[model samples]
Target: MFYFLKQRFSHLAIPEKNAKRIGMFRTLCAIFGGLCVAYLGMTLLLFILPVSPGESLVIPLLFNTLAWALASLWIVLAPTRLRALWRSVLPTLCFAVLIVFFFFKESM
Candidate 1:
């Protein structure tokens, strides 16, 4: 069955056992990373740059959308998909930690 698939749809086929196993993992990670990039990109921009409230809210929204698109593109184009996943995952984790830390700190 899969052999027929490989023959007919080589581009979509799982090239190897490892890639087959990791495909789902990579896909999920890419999705999560894209979301994280959008959120983190916006937060980082607001945290680091001086964007006043008087300005249109669309600025950050546009950046957030662009960030997600770039992250998704990077994941798809990367030579080593696992490495790409980790690269985004690390930053996502870092942003999550920072967000949590600040949330707690403010409450204290």
Candidate 2:
């Protein structure tokens, strides 16, 4: 199953530009960068929202899951195309923001 998925994504995989094998630094950087972006985006949304304490808890969980699922799908299917990744990300972010805005507006 793993092999099949990898094969399907072979075209989207980045070609190694250097002879050096994957190193710890590169792996760490990728993980950290992804986490930082996710955290920063979530934090920004949390501040903009005016939810009650109980409601606020659910918002982060829902948004994070939705964002991560979308991001994971894009990473798996469009890895080679940075533009495709950005295009996917922007819409998801906008959707999250819109949801928050409406939720707050309705609560008021």
By TM-score, who's the top model here? Answer: 1
Assess candidate 1 and give its lDDT. 0.66
Which candidate number would show the highest lDDT if scored against the true structure?
Answer: 1
Residues 1-108 of candidate 2: C-alpha lDDT, one tens digit per residue: 999978755643554455355434334333443444455456556656787656676677667656655454444343243434454456556656765776687689
Q: What is the TM-score of each candidate against the true structure?
A: 0.58, 0.38
Give the C-alpha miss distance for residue 101 in model 1, angstroms. 8.2
> Tell me, what's the RMSD of every candidate?
8.8, 10.5
Q: List the residue pairs that clash in candidate 2.
A: none
Separately for all candidates shown, the number of backbone clashes (residues 3 or more apart, or on different chains) is: 0, 0
Candidate 1, run of 10 with poorest lDDT = 11-20
* Model 1 misplaced regions, further than 4 Å: 1-22, 54-56, 96-108
Q: Candidate 1, residues 1-108: lDDT per residue as tens digits?
A: 999856755444334345435466456666777888778867755544556644645677789878888787676554455566666788788877776775576579
